[model samples]
Every structure is written in structure tokens, then in C-alpha cells.
Target: MAPGYALALAFSVALLVTTDAGNPGLVARITQKGLDYARQQGIIVLKQKLSTLHLPDYSGSYDVGVLGNVDYDINSMVVTDLQLPSSEVTLLPNVGLKLTVSGAYIEIHGKWRVHYLFISSHGDFELKVLGISISVGLSLGSDGSGRPTISTADCSAHISDMQVHFSGGLDWLINLFDDTIASSLRDNLQKQICPLVADAIQNQLEPVLRTLPVTSNIDDVAAIDYSLTGPPIVTAENLDVQLKGEFFERSHRSPPPFSPLPLSIPDDHSLMVYFAVSEYLFNTAGFVYQSAGKLIFNVTDDMIPKDFPVRLNTSSFGKMIPQISKMYPDMLMKLKISSPSAPSLAMKPGNVTISPLLDIQAYAILPNSSLAPLFLLNLSTDAVAKLGVNSSRIVGHLELSSITIALERSDVGPFPVQILSFAVNYYISHILLPEVNDILKNGYPLPLLDHIQLSNLMLKLNEHYLLLGADVQYE
Candidate 1:
């Protein structure tokens, strides 16, 4: 709520500061061109802030020798028009940002009251401020909670011209000391410009930046944490930020057992902004779901196609494994399939893949309405993921590439495990993959400000990381 990060913080939620560059699960880069775009938007806000500048009513009593004692007060002062025709934002190497506004203009209308030798006259006056210029330096950092923080490094302002006009009063008497009155007015207005700019940055823009969401809800079951892992990295051409891109269950929020590997993205400046995402993010989702027991699926006859030639009964499986029919005669079987451990995702050049170790337990339904253990098979499979950007989310689908099945244990005597491979593969292909795809269809929200939208996206996959470059629009 206090003075914090500046315009860059709102640019795309992609701003940073100084900290040890460990392996970051997520990294955001803002190119110089991005800063250029932000500068244009910043000028509009700057003008609005300046238009609200309040100057204390000026009152003074002076003796002009021949004029005796002259008392004057300027009140009801209000800014009528303000213009910032030109401004520039420059990134300071290893420092922060420098913004300069030149050729600016302002006009103020006020009422003037003058008392000269017991003769009181009141009238309206206009003050025109011209050739105004301002310079501000802003530095970005992180707060104790890893949210970005911005503060004013330095500021300066200069006013080259000020003209005051008086009307509808004793013009002859007022003109006698017009120069003196204008000098005092100019001094009062000039001294407040830089301070007002600083106040706007500290009291106004800073609060808005602090409101930038550091974490967002993905769905009812899971939430993602995009909290800064450390301060940002400042380069001559880019401002880089690192984040802990991990997901946790909605009810149980805890860190995953695995740590992120070193992540690096190409320094391509063609795009305005870039995001580097590591596999740690997806792995954390796997960990959360696995821990919450959401990764398990129960496959029964109803889950299979009704028109399929074979059912989930022992009579159908007996054609291959005769021992099953001899022992249970005819009984419906169910497969309780689940992952043995958290699945891990691997990113490579032009590809992303995940390998899951699933445990499938076979059971037979008895007349007593209870499950009887039959066999347990371990399934290992590789799946390729196709990822795309939808609005501000990352959506993906998985395709099974290869699978291998091995018999871990059997309660109904030893039989060729390969005999059931066709059936098991069918369940994974038709049943498991479809369910996984449905979840992915909802997609995951990217680590961006809620109001920011991305377009013209280009994706590049590298070892251990994927870089997403896109142009952003701030709503």
C-alpha cells in the first residue's frame, strides 16, 4: 500500500530487481521496446497526475515605496489545460528507468484579490505555464513477500516561462505592481512541480502496482503460485524476473519434494516480452494431484464402449488366461488404475514429453458385494504434449507415444501378461488419455496481470525450459 513498484510492474507483471540467480522455475524478460510502449502509456498517466497538482493560495504584503502597502491573495486556482507533447523512457544499465518529459504546457485560472491603500479590487486572472520539463528516475525491487517494489531514485523539474494576466478590476492600479505579483506566483508554482510528480509516483502509481496479483487461482482444485523467488535481474537491454512457478492443491498447500532444475531462455529481443517456463511447474501439479489422490481412476465395464466385443468379465479374459475362468467361473472385474509416483515432464528442443508409472490393480466382484484382489500390473508410458496459448492461458493435450507393461504380482497364478496388453492399452488410450485431455482443456493461467492479454505469440522449446514470446495489451 505504501510507495512501491512503478509502471514497469504493471507493464505485464514482468518486472524484477537484485538477487542470486538460482534455477528459476519461471522467468520474465521485458525488452527495451517493451519499455518504449510503456513510456507512451506512462505519459498519459503523468499528465493526469499533473493536472491534479494543488498549489497553495499565495498571499503576501509588500511595500512598493510609492505604492505604500500592497496586499494580494490568489485563490480558486485550478488547472484548465495540460499537455505533454514529448516524453522518453530510457533503461539505465544495472540501475532502473529514467523518464524525461519536455515541451510540456499548463494553464491555470484563478481569482485575484488586491488591496492597495484601502482600495480593494477583485478580478479573475489566468496563468500560463510554458516550456516545462521534468526528469524522474525509478528503481525496481522486491518486498519481503517477494512482490515487486518500486521507489523514486531521483527527480527534477524546470519551468522556463510563466505569464499572469489580470482583468475586470482596477487595471491601472494592479498593473503598477503586476511584475512583483507575477514573480511571487511563478516562484510558488515552480517549487511544487517536482514534488508533485514524486508524490504521484509514491502515493498514486505505487499503490496500483502493488495490487498486481502475484498468485492466481487456476481452478477449484488447484492454484498456482507465481511469487518472485528473488529480486529481478537488470541488464542493459532487458529487465528479468524470476518466480517460483509451482502449483498446489486448493485444500493442501505444500512445497513439492523435487526442486527445479536450471532454466535458461534465449535472449531474443524481437518480441516485447518473453516468459521462460521450466518443467518444475508441471511436475508440481503432478505432485499435488498425486498427493491428493486425484490421479487414480476406476475403470469398469460401464467405462468401456458398450458395443465392444469383450466385457470386463473373467469369462472374456478367460479366452487368454484359462486360470481365471477355472477359479472364478464368471465374474465382473474392475481395474483400479493410479500413478505410483508423481509424473515428471521433460522439455526438449521442439518437444515436451512426460513419463508416468501407473499401477493397475485387477479385482473381481463377489456376490457379497466386495472386491477380491486378482492381479497387479505396472504400466510405464511416454506421452507427448502439444501446448498452445489461449488468450492468457496455456492449454495442452497429450498423445501416448509408447507403453510397456510388466507383471508385478499375480494372485491367480502365473500367466502370460502380454495377453492382457491389448485390453490395458485400450483403457489408457480411450479412457485415461481422454480424461487427462479434458482437464488440460481448461488450461492453466499464465503468470500475467489479470487485465493483460497476450497475442502474436511464438513458442520455442529448449532443454528443461520453454520460452513464450508475445505482444501484450493492457486492458
Candidate 2:
């Protein structure tokens, strides 16, 4: 789920809790719903690193007393059956992994060729090895480039049942060499196979894991850096990983927020993300808004229609205003508005409030003169909006809300700016509010990994951080 949607969902839940007598059951239901979604997405399923093992062929030449340096080759050597006990996988927190596979069996059937001093013979061979098991310990580290790396600390293999058979070769010679060949092969395999398997896993699997992308892009808007903070933790049922990074944009760059308190792993959720919303994010947003300046709408006498809410009520400003208006050939007025301060955001039950110090300046154009400021007013307004997602972009919808004007400013002492409350509210509802929403319509996009995405996500707002919970899903 996207963070925008999560924030909205969390707000809804908060509303229920606050308005519905704080029912614990409803909160539990919401959490359970998130968990169910996670399960459906397959985030709860544990993935195994090594699922199958295959050995193609093993061939060598051996010295036989009477046969005088016999050469033998075993073709099509394969093992397809393997098992892993539920308790065999263990995790060492901030460390590595220990895995054990037991009760494995290999039914081997292959062709063998043997060459004597002057004679060559070929035959079929059948062998069954039962009660096979292996135990391996892996250590996690990092390569020179800071990518994850895995190395084998210890490995051992055991074989209990060994049966061998041969056909077509002379019975006497075969019988004489069968026991010796089997014994020598078993000893050599027992000593060498474990290290070879370990090497293959480290060399082949490590690079794939390390190359996994940790950064996410959102077209031309922004890029989120999600580099891993440390190596992943592997346990019996799942793997846990953590990321700590920041967002980057061409026009806006700010230092990351300070780290919040450590997160507690929750058993009910398969995945969790913690975001610390720093002062930098808010300050950067403010800078962007200030740089854009004010929005203006022009009004003309002829533009007013019959249904227009605005009337030419010069009677309120008295006879002098009407006389002054008559002297100007063309009368024009502009309502210029700007938010001088970047909006400060706060969260409540089912709502997010953005309060920005607004600077409203009205202008009038006199004949043959440049636009002049008619009036200047400074006040603060709270714009409430709801979060959502649209076409992969996080958006906000403004709500019909009231605005409060700040009258404590020293410069506006004794002035009746409060009388303009209705006009300010109207302007915000129709214009300023939409502008703020437009700025927020492109909220951060969710991070993704190829075909996988986070499912049924929810966000929780804390004093200093934003907590996200969800499950993984593969397309």
C-alpha cells in the first residue's frame, strides 16, 4: 500500500477511536485486516536459499593390483531427493545463519566404463545412499564495495547406508574391486563434498543478493535512497532487513531527519517501516512555496455578471469611493495572496492540518500608473486536507474548514482584521486551499522491488516519526 493511503487509513481509524468510545475491538480489527492482507500477499512465506542440489558426474582412474591401473568413469550422477527439518534453520541476530538438513536419501543409477591394460569393459551401476545429512554454518559480512557477503564457517556431511552394484564386467574382477572402490570413493566424497557445496553457495548466491536495488525512483519528481543499514537477519521462518536513507530532488535537498527511537518488531505484521520526518522536510517545503510567490486573480467592472457573488457596493466605502471610481477611466483590482511561511503540519484523529502564515496584499491600478498596493494584511490560516493516492501519485483533498486570524501581532494592534475572516475563508476554500492541495498531490511514492510491493499498509504518526506496517506481495 502507498504511504498516502496508509496515512488516510490511519486517520480513519483514529476517528473511530476518538468518536466511538475508544473501542479496542475496532482497532484490533484494523490491525488484523492488515495482517490478513500481508498473508494474502505471501509476505509471511519463508524463502529458502538452497532448494535443490545436483552433481552431474564424477570420474577418476584407480590402481588395481591385478588389473594394473584401471581407469573408471561414473556418468549421470544425480541427487533429486532432499529434506529439511522445521527446526534446522536458526538465526543469530546481527550475525549469520546456521542450517542443517537431515533424513536425505540419494538413489543413484549411472553407467560406468573401465579400461584395463589391454582390455576395455563397460557396465551399468546402481547405488542407493540412505540417511544422508549435512550441517552448515555461514558468516555474514560485507565486500569491499559495502555489499552483503556470505562465507562458510563450518560444514559437515554424513552418510549411513551405502549400496553398490555392477553388471557386465567379469564377476571375479568386479567382486574383487567393488569393496575397495566403494570404500575409497566414500572416504574421498565425505571429505571433499561439503567444502565444494559451501563454495558454490557463496560464489553464486552472494552476488545476486548484493545486487538487489535499494533505491526507488518516481519519474522526474524525486528519488528515495533506501540503502541497507546492515546485513539481513535470517531465521527459521523469515528474513528481516532494515533501511535508513533520505529523499532527493533537483530543486529541494535537505538533511535527513534525526533518528528516532528503535522500532520494536511486531509478530502480527510481516513487514514494518519507520520514517523520521525531520525539520528539513518541512523547511524545504516551505522554501519551495515561498519561492513560488503569490497567486493573483484580477477583477474588472465589466467581468461581473448577473449571478456573480461580488457586487459593486461602493455604498459601504461611502460617497468618496464612488466619486474616485468615476474619475478613473478603467478600474482594475487584483487580490494577491501568498503564504509567507512554509506550512507546519500536524496530525489529529482522521485529519492533517497545515497552518501557514498568510500574507494577503490587495492591489489597484490607477490610470497611466503601475499597479499599487491598496492594502496589506498578515494572518494565519489552518487548512485541513485528507490524503489519498491517484494514478500512483499521492494526493490531497481539501475539506470545507474554518480559518482563524491571528490578531496578536504588534503591527496590527487595535486593527479590526478579524472583520475580514469571511473573505479570508472564502479565498482559502476556493483558491489557497486548492493550491496547497496541488502542492501535496504528488506525495512520496512507495518503494518497490521488481514485481513485489507492500500490501495492506497503514501509517502511524508519532511525535517524531511515522511508522508503517504492511506485507510483501509479488505480481
Candidate 3:
């Protein structure tokens, strides 16, 4: 049950939480349907553990009416077959989880030796245990490092019936007292079951929980933080976990400028898990790249297709402002386009938009290989992004909704701002956006637990956040 226990502790550490905007940026919910799957896996693991059980030798002396004093020892008991036909997992609301197993049956083979004063009889025996039942309650919490911790709150095991059959000379005499021997065996078996369960949780499951990566590198430039913001929230139908799903620059771990907005995920049992990501996650990415100075790009004439009507040179600008044709004719030009600040994202019920402030500096090449400053334009735009999940990452493309252009400074003298606006908008729509889209097509990685895969996913845009509902497959 290590895997099942790991899954439970990993996702099951909460109660009703406050709706503070500073609440966890990431929230995941595990429904009853998910618990059912976990229960199935748990039973398989339990059976394997029980099959290797080591029961201590049982030896005792008892007096039988006509047989006088009889002494018997049952040793080297080995489990031959075990069956767990019924089990269930139930959420205990504020208490955590309770697992109950009933109707379990087990068969054991062992050696028995009995002494009756003058003679001793030795042979093999069969022990059948029936109506076995076990119940365990688990309490989940987190350690200082944000890793989940699991401890057994309460546990119990019961054996309703045990029958022993002996085969050997004078075995008939021992059979008459087998009921008394079986009772002692039943008591010993019941005492071992719960302690083994507790040890498995402490020794096997707790270590796996520590292996969860709270922070993982997404790429060379950035890494994501998936640490729990606080303890989990528990409801009758769900176990909710909250995480600080923010990305930071690899070299610098500065916090993002904005805080996560209040996010919520409805109970959807059909899916194994539900992940709700806030706008803060995307904005932190913008901040990381902006702070890293990786958001800037230099566009040259060589990058433009030769067949384009307008070239990136003084000659092309001269068509609009004739003064440029007399000064630097046939000279090439360069545009250094970069964001002055981190772009901000705005999400609403059916739309997700972004506003980025950019500074585009145009320069003309001089005969001496020096750059002659032409003009500078401050650009801002309203763009909407179409998002999709690819593999474990989120991939998206931006669509320009509106553009704003302003002349900040110029060395070639003043020209009508309206004149360059058309060309600027056209350049952005046809050239710059395509390049941005190409990079966005690669997408950013999403934080996920080990060996967990998302399938049958659905993404929904809500006010201030994005909800991703998916069925999870544990490898």
C-alpha cells in the first residue's frame, strides 16, 4: 500500500479555508472516485504484505479429560493463500481518511508437535483463518518543508474464526483440543496485523512523501515553485491542496510583484484531480524573463523577406519622411524591440488578455559602421492568448486586439505620429507577432507530482484565474 499511501498523503493534507486573495495560487482536489481507485491499489499491496507475514511460534499445555495433560507446539507457520474480497476508503471530513477491510480469509501451513507423558507425536497441520477484518484511520499533515506527513490516528484488526487440523499418529486426540489451540493462534495473529500496518506507513510511505519536489526546474532560464501555501482543506466530497504555483528566474529567486487572486475549484468527482491556476503564475513568468533581460530582440533587414514591398532601411522611411532620403540613402536599419516592464495578464470568463509595454528604438547604419539614431516609439497593446495544454505544460499563442503607439524621441526631426502608426501596426501584426508566436508554441512547463499524468483535461477561463480539470493516471 505504499503507492496508495503516498498518493493519499501527497494530496490529502486540509478543512474549510478562508477566501483570501493571498490564498494558494494552485488548488487540487481528489474526489471519491479517485479514492476508489486508490483503494483498489491498496488492496493489492496489502495482500502482498500479508502473504509474507512472520507469525511467532505458539506453544502451550492443556489438560484433556481422558487424554490427561497434553502439550503441543505449532511452529514455522507459513501463509499458503490469502484473500481480501472487500475493502473501502472513506473520507472522515475533518479527521482525514479511514480504510476498512472485511471478509478476508487466509490459509496457513505449519508443523506441530504434541507430547502426552509417555509418547510424542509430530506432523504437519493446516490453519484456516476466516472473517478477518481490519480498519485503519490516517491523519495527514505537512512538515516544515511543505512535504506531507502521514500518521496512523487509530487502527484495529480482528479475527472471527480460526480452525486447525492435525495429521499424524494419535492426531485424533489432538483434534479434540484443536479449538483451544486455534483460539490462541487467533489472538496472536490479530496482535501482529495493526503494528505491521503502522510500520509500513512510517517506514515506507513517509519516505516517498519526502521525495516530492517542492520546487522543480522548468528550463534553463526558470524554475517553478509548487510548495504548499498552507495546510489542505477537507470537505465531505473532496480533499483540497493549495500550492504557491509561481515561477522565478533561475539565477534570482525574487518574489513576483503581484499576489495570487482567490481561486476555487468545484467538486467534480468524474475526474481524478482538478488544478486551478491563477493569473499570478503567468505574470511571474513575465517578470522572470523581464528581469533576466531575455525579453529583448533586435530586428534587422536580413530577417525580413526580400519579396516584401517595404525594406528595413532609410530608403523605406524616406518614402514617408522625405528628409531621410537625402541624409542616409540605401543604408540599412535596425529595430531594438524590448519590454520596459513586465507584462500583466487579465483573465475573464471567456477571455484571457495581456497588456505589455514595449520600447522600439530605430537606428540607421552610418557609412563608418556607427548607428545614427532615427527615432524611438513607445508601444503598448491589448492582446488575447489562446491557451492549450501540451504534455504537462501549457502552450499558448497571442492575438493582437488593439495597438497604441507614441513617439518618445527622434534625431531625424519630427514626423507625423499618425504616419508611422500604420507601418508600426503592420510590422507588429505581420512580423513581430509571428516571431512571438513561434516561441510561445513551445510553451511553459507545469508542476506535477512524480509519475502522475493528466488526461481527459478541460480548461476553463474564469475571472482572474484558469481552471484545469483532468483525470490523473499514476504510473
Candidate 4:
């Protein structure tokens, strides 16, 4: 298959197996934060109008005549003191959201122009609106770029009490017709202002969502791609978002055979992420190791005392010597190590295992003559690991619990030396494990989308995948 095609196929397979379902509480928290942020910005403008107004003769205003063909223009409307109570969100079947905004108060300032008797009278008006409520029904879907978007289906707004204050030449006229003016304003606002608010929300929110960094690159070596599969689900308690994607290294190699299948979502979590381990991700590590060739560790004579004594006690080697001293006390030992093959990953309940084959060789000069082989060993170790996530990044640690040494003839000895097993195991446990941990310590940085972070992260491992879940909090 073509490289791009292969990559796409792999991603599809990964998604089929990996299901990253969201938590309702986390969704609600994120939505609330987003709303709070919008309120803080405080610059939404709503322009509405009533084309014409008809009135009978005014009773009090300077012997006014019948008012007909009165046009009204609300030049600008700003919302303040807007509050969203602890309202519930309901997901319309296969659509978007049934949102409720209750106990909201807004202070609006606008200019109203009225045309009456071939004369236009303009006035600056201030309205203190109380007992405001809004209900919106919309569908959440993705745009061309895979960002979440909203399509309004229905919207309605209600205002129980509105105190209107007016200025300019028409001020006294409006005061005289306060009740009529209020009723007209309410009718116009319900028809025009409500829909405008809904549209304004969509316009403000969609762009912000699109700009979020859902996909992230890690140190130019690997990348985590987050692509949405469908629109978010809104429920009475919270919102649920589903994400599917894959992680791949720069090498484009596939993961080893043991890569796990995706796991299921955990129960009652504020936020949950279910991820499948891909062959590409595991093989990438091997490719990087192979490209670096061999790693050499030099032990100088100064590091080891001249009278250093080593003991060998194993079933294979028995007790050969009580203590063996180095013949060439001043010489240095060079240990060369390399991974002969790629590493494989397997997921177990609450842990993951990584197995890699290693080839190790050590050489040192003897007092009598030339350099000699101290030992040569081939082995595979299973490093079981666990991951922890913080606000900034994920951290991992590994423990080598199983080791299998492949016996082979070497110049150093006629039989397999027990000391070689101990040496290789020590190198893997003490040296290799820490190096892997360090790499994991600098793991993928969590993207802060719109100043929101995943907090209190927890992990669970299953037969085929790892599940990461967390609560949502503002940074």
C-alpha cells in the first residue's frame, strides 16, 4: 500500500478498536468555563429593530397627534449581569443540545430612532432587564477542519420586567407611552434579539474551538493526533465528547506484535480517554535505538579499585571462586550494548509490559597480553510500566520483572557464566530502566485548550489498551 494509505488504514483500525468516550461532568465544567470566559470578554453586540409602530392620540405629551408609521431601530444592545444558573443540558436525539439559561439579568444600552408625522426622533435608551431566561436547541457537528461547530435549530428568550430610561427629544414622549413602549420592546426583542444572541454565541464559540490545539507534536520525534469522530452528546448532567486518533513517530515504523487493543471506558469519571497502543508507536522506539547504533559504557581503573573482588554464585556456574581479582588492575573495561530487534508492548490490568531483545558485550585488557572478551550475552527483558499524568505531562516508570538469557559460546569461557546474567540484569534494571523513565518524564505535553486543563488524572490498563480519565479544571 502507499505510505499515506497505510497510515490512514492504521489510523482507522486504531479508531475502530479505541473508544475515547467523555465524561458528562467534565463536559459541563468545560462548557461552564467557556461561558464564563465569554462573559468576561463582555463585547457582544446585538442590533434589533421594529419596522413600524402604530399609536392612538397621546394623552399627555404636548398635544401629540395620532402616531402612525413609527419606525424603531435599536442601534446597539450590550448584555451585562448575565448569569447562568445551575441548569441542565439535554442532548436532542442525534442532534445537538437543549440548553437552558435561567436567572440571567442584562443591562442594555441602545439608541432607538422613531419616525412619526414626517419627523424622526432619536433617543439614547438604557434598559435594566430582570428575570431573563433563554432556551436554545442546536446541533453540534464538525466543520471541514474537524472542529466542533453548532447549528441553531430553535431559540427563545423571555424577560419578566424591563425598566426603560430614555433621553433626547423623544424622552418625554416615551415616558408618556411607557407601557405601550415596553410591550412593543418586549415583542421585538423576543422576535429579533433572542435569535441574534444565539447566533452571536455560535459565531464567538466556533472560532475559539477551531483554534484549539487538539493535535500535538512531541519534540519533533512523535505526534499525537486528536480527530473528532462525531458531535458531542449533551445530557441532563453533562456533555460527552468522543475522540479517535493515533500516535506515530517520525520513523513511520509499525509497532511490535504485542501492541494492545483499545480498552473500555471507566465508570463515573469526570473525563475519560480510551487509547489503543499502535504498532507504529512501539516500533518507533526500536527504530530510534537502531539508528543510534551501539551505546558504549566505559569503566576506568580508577572507578574500580585494584583490589576489587567479585563473587560468582549461581546454579549454572556453582561457586567457582570465593573472590576473583582483576589481573589487569590498571586496565579499563568497555561494555557495548545494542538492541538487536524492535520492542513490543502489551497491556495488562493496570500495567503495561515492554519486551526488547538486547545484545551486550564486554572487553578488557589482561596484564599478560592483548584485549580479551570478558563476556557476551543475549537476553530479552520484560519491563512492566505504569503511567501518571500531571497538568503539564505524563510520567512513566518501568520495572524489569522477567529476563531470559540466551546461552551462546564466547571467547571468554567454555560454558555460560552466571556473572554475565547478573551483570546484564543489573544494567537493564538500574541503567536502562532510568533512561526509559527519563524519556517518559518528558512525555507528551497536555494541550491547554482555552485555558482549560485536565486535572486529577487517573489511569487504568486492560487487555488491549490504556484508559486515561481526569476531571476538568481551569488553569
**Each model's RMSD to truth, in Å?**
6.8, 9.1, 7.1, 9.2
Q: Write the per-residue lDDT of candidate 4 for residues 1-475, one digit (tens) a residue.
A: 2112221121122111123342111121233343333333422322211111112212222224565335455556554344444344554656766666666555666666665667767778787666767777767776555457776777787878878888997766556556666666666556664556665666765556676455666434455545454566554433445444445455453433333233334344344232333333433434443443322333333433334342221211223311212332444455555556545565567656667666666556455645566556787776666566676455665666888887554553455456456655655565555555555555555434576566666656556554555555544
Clash count for each candidate, listed in order shown? 4, 1, 5, 4
Worst 10 residues of 1 by lDDT: 1-10
In TM-score terms, candidate 4 sits at 0.63
Estimate, for each residue in 1-475, the C-alpha lDDT of model 2 and write its tens digit.
2212222221121111111111111111113333234333321121122223343466666666765777677676544333333225455545666656566555556677777677777777766665667777778764443345678888888877677788777534555567665665566556655765575566655544565454455334344444545554444444454443333443555532332234333354344322223222333333433343312233333433455354323222113234324433344655445555444555544556555565666545566656655457676555565655422223456564556675433221234666556555655565444443444555554433345455555655544233445554445
Clashing pairs in 2: 1-454
Give the C-alpha miss distance for residue 194 in model 2, angstroms.
Answer: 6.3
For all candidates in order, the CA lDDT equals 0.76, 0.47, 0.75, 0.50
Runs in model 3 lying further than 4 Å from the true structure: 1-21, 117-120, 367-370, 417-427
- Give the C-alpha lDDT of model 2: 0.47
Strongest candidate by TM-score = 1
Q: In candidate 1, which residue pairs get closer than 3 Å at backbone N, Cα or C atoms, i.e. clash? A: 4-150, 5-150, 16-232, 17-232
Q: Which pairs of residues collide in candidate 4?
A: 254-279, 255-279, 255-280, 261-464
Give candidate 2's TM-score. 0.61
The order of the candidates by TM-score, greatest first, is: 1, 3, 4, 2
Off by over 4 Å in 4: 1-87, 108-126, 143-146, 151-153, 158-173, 191-203, 230-240, 251-262, 269-336, 361-376, 408-413, 446-450
Q: Using TM-score as the measure, name the better of candidate 1 and candidate 2.
A: 1
- Candidate 3: count the clashes: 5
| lDDT by residue (tens digit), candidate 1, 293-382 | 666667788778987766888898888888887788789888887778877777788888777788999988887869988899999898
